[model samples]
Target chain A: MKINRREFVKRMSAGAAVTALAGCMSNAGRPAAGRVVVIGAGYAGATAAKYIRLWAPDIDVTLVERDAEFISCPLSNLVLGGSKTIRDMTVGYGGLAKYGVKLMRDDAVAVDPVKREVRLASGASLQYDRLVVAPGVDVQYDTLPGLASADAQSKVLHAWKAGAQTVALRKQLETMRDGGVYAVHIPKAPYRCPPGPYERACQVAHYFKTAKPKSKVLILDANEDVVSKKGLFMAAWNGPYKGIVEYRPNSELEDVDASTLTAKLQFGSVNADVLNVIPPQRAGNIALVTGLITANNRWCGVNWQTMESIKVPGVHVLGDATLSAQLMPKSGHMANQHAKVCAAAIIAMIKHEPVNQEPMMVNTCYSFIDDKNVVHVASVHAYDASEKTMLPIKGAGGLSDKANELEGTYALSWAKNIWADMLG
Target chain B: MAVAVGCPLNAHAQDANSIRGMAATCANCHGTEGRSAGTVPGLAGVDKTQIVQQMQDFKTGKRASTIMQQLARGFTDAQIEQIAAWFSAQKK
Candidate 1:
């Protein structure tokens, strides 16, 4: 316990040593703090990693990210519409280094929770006092036929993850004939980004309006009605792009035929020049491999106060991977909010301080109907001691009155601020 | 950490971190610790009275906003005072 700070730094791993030195400088009299290994550098994990170091500089934070750059899923639809490029949504992880978070550019292939370690694909192991898993979502192709193979998936792009496929899908629309039908199949509810599919429709339709007037944007939704920002999206579809966009609800997908570019629905089949099928989704692969999917074997359950896994000790799950509370949506903004709360809890836990009994989080999601006009859904969730969960505050959140250029500006500004908040 | 500067002696130290967590929800649009990076106005170093009053106006429809009107109504009066103080204490 009386070991010198320099000795401790030399004894620790490269990743932990630098942070330990920083901690020693800032926290002169304190002991070297515990280690926190966070998996997936999306909105949640990146924010968590940064905030943990910001608040409690003594703790060693190592962030594991497979991708060299972070491509945002929000505003990715603009790339599909040709309004923005993939570079606009991509950012580097170098910002995290400034906060003393060691960036481990490797995949966390396995978790040994009992031994309190994570095994990376590079044959390296990370031991942690706490593990944060924010693996976003994994789109399951096996649930749908003709989409299980790589060739079929290549032909019918999901573009849901917002990277290369986003650009490829844009290419498909650009090359499609003037009058060709570009159909997008929406999966059932509880998918990532509830209003994403509809916003995507508007984006594609906007492209169709300018480039190919006769081209149609078809929305085949499995849900009975619009899932989020219903009135706002309806107004856009009816008022602006009335002739261009078509909506068919309750059109459940039985299978897909990539060769014919047809979506085989339970009722019938519809052929299209470009078929974008957003298949059913579950928690990411790491969540699956770690056996943390507790809800319907799809989402992990967590203690709302700390986001610690209900099934496993010392492991916390965040963002879309967790079973959402009553009113929470799987949006990046909400994920960022979740990261702050998790970071605060982890810091307090490390310091043996009392975790906040009352926690409040807010979600503000903006969807661009076109490039300039946007609609949004906002809500606030407060921790309820009685229910032991976060409950949406009544009358505090709602949809935008309508789509407008002002909110569209706020949408981009929001993206810039949030990205800076997480990555920087 | 700047939140501790202006905190009254009567304020519970633990409650400071609690308010910090609550105030961070605003950082998605506002910048970290309310130092905005984009079109949204930064909240850092603003007067507590001004911040609280604006939040009250937004909540009561006295101020018009693209999204703040809806977000302001979420916080109770007491919570707004604490959050305002935290942001007010931060450097611009």
Candidate 2:
């Protein structure tokens, strides 16, 4: 059970020995003191991975991600407005490597906690003393028939996965016929970004107003009104893109005929020259398969302070995968923040340390309604031990009842500062 | 420049001293040991690698943090190891 440091170091450089040691590390978890394996390289996973390495460099750390570069969805909408490109949103993982983290460019397919192993699509198994799962959100395209995620490439572009999907969607918008109709479908609640579809609509309308005057945008929102960042969205859509943007609230898109470029809606069909669909989403399929989500359509349930799965031990869920009634729509910013909360818990457990009795969590979501203005929603969290819930600080940080130039300016500054805090 | 004498993180119990010093600095705004005064943050219980990496990022300019970079730039490799050691061992 004793692994000499020299032997461990010797084994680490050699690939076969690394794997062997990794296996041995899994089986030798006598008292939960060793390497921690983090799956998913999104805000959640990346946040967890970096924290583990920072807290315990002596303990081995490995990050598993399918993509080499991460394109942030936060500032991505500006890409559609011609102010930014996907390249502007892209980030490298070299920061993690510099911290001595092992990067595995492979998809994690499954995990067996009993065996303390994470099986990847590459047929490699990663051993962990403690496992942190931060895979982020997964779209359930099947929620809407004839309009799956694959539809992004052929007819309607979701462009939510970043990389090629984002670029393809941009190209689709770029080559779209001038003065032609462009459409966006807002899915049901708890999607990746609450104000994303609307911000996207505004960005498109910005393009159309300048490039294609005759073109109009039709936004079919499944909800009664804009969800997150409501004031800012209404201000932009109503003030800036007012006449050009046709917003249909509480009207869901029932069907899509990609060939003819038409969307059938509860209200009526809207024919379009180009279509962008943000489909209904839930926790990642990996979470669903692992029973992290419930039949109530909520993601994993957990003790708000610890973020440990109420149903499973040695497994913690963060990001869009958990049901935190305290927070607003799931955003990468929130996910990253939540991952830190969970990380704090994990580090404590390794040394048999007592956790803080009351936990405080925070998250902010920024929406770029237009070039001149951006708005943000923020909140402070308090974990209630009795209720097993994380509640907001009532008057702390929420959207403005009336967004003005001052609010907009503050939001812009807040975003710049927050991004610096999270990804900076 | 000579190292700050009477620095809270003295030679005795280097690990705890470094951890408390790091936490105290962050707590100036983030609250004690990573907890915040509502606006800043609570670093009491966060990812260890992420915290250290973020500090590293701020120090190297990979990420932007005026105060954090200033704070991070002051730490040496041994300090970082000690800081990570103390904070990661904290409970949420």
DockQ for model 1 equals: 0.47
Candidates' C-alpha lDDT: 0.91, 0.67
- By summed lDDT, the worst window of 10 consecutive residues in model 1 chain A runs over A23-32
The lowest-lDDT stretch of 10 consecutive residues in candidate 2 chain A is A23-32
TM-score, cand. 2 vs. native: 0.75
True contacts kept of 2: 0.00
lDDT of 1 by residue, A1-424 (tens): 7879887776775656566555423332345498999999999999999999988898999999999999999999999887999999999999888999999999999999999999999999999999999999999887787888899999999998989999999999999999999999999989999999999999999999989999999999999999888889889889889999999999989999999999999998999999999998999999999989999878999899999999998999999999999999999999998899999988877766668888899999999998899998999999999999999999898888989999989999999999999998
Candidate 2: which stretches are off by over 4 Å?
Answer: A1-32, A148-153, A295-298, A400-424, B1-92
TM-score of 1: 0.93
Best by TM-score: 1
Candidate 2 lDDT (Cα, 0 to 1): 0.67
Predicted candidate 2 versus true structure: per-residue lDDT over A323-410, tens digit per residue: 7565545877667666666666676666444444455555556566666566666665656777767776564455544444554444
Reference-based lDDT, residue A83, model 1: 90
In candidate 1, the residue pairs with backbone N, CA or C atoms under 3 Å apart (3 or more residues apart, or in different chains) clash, namely none
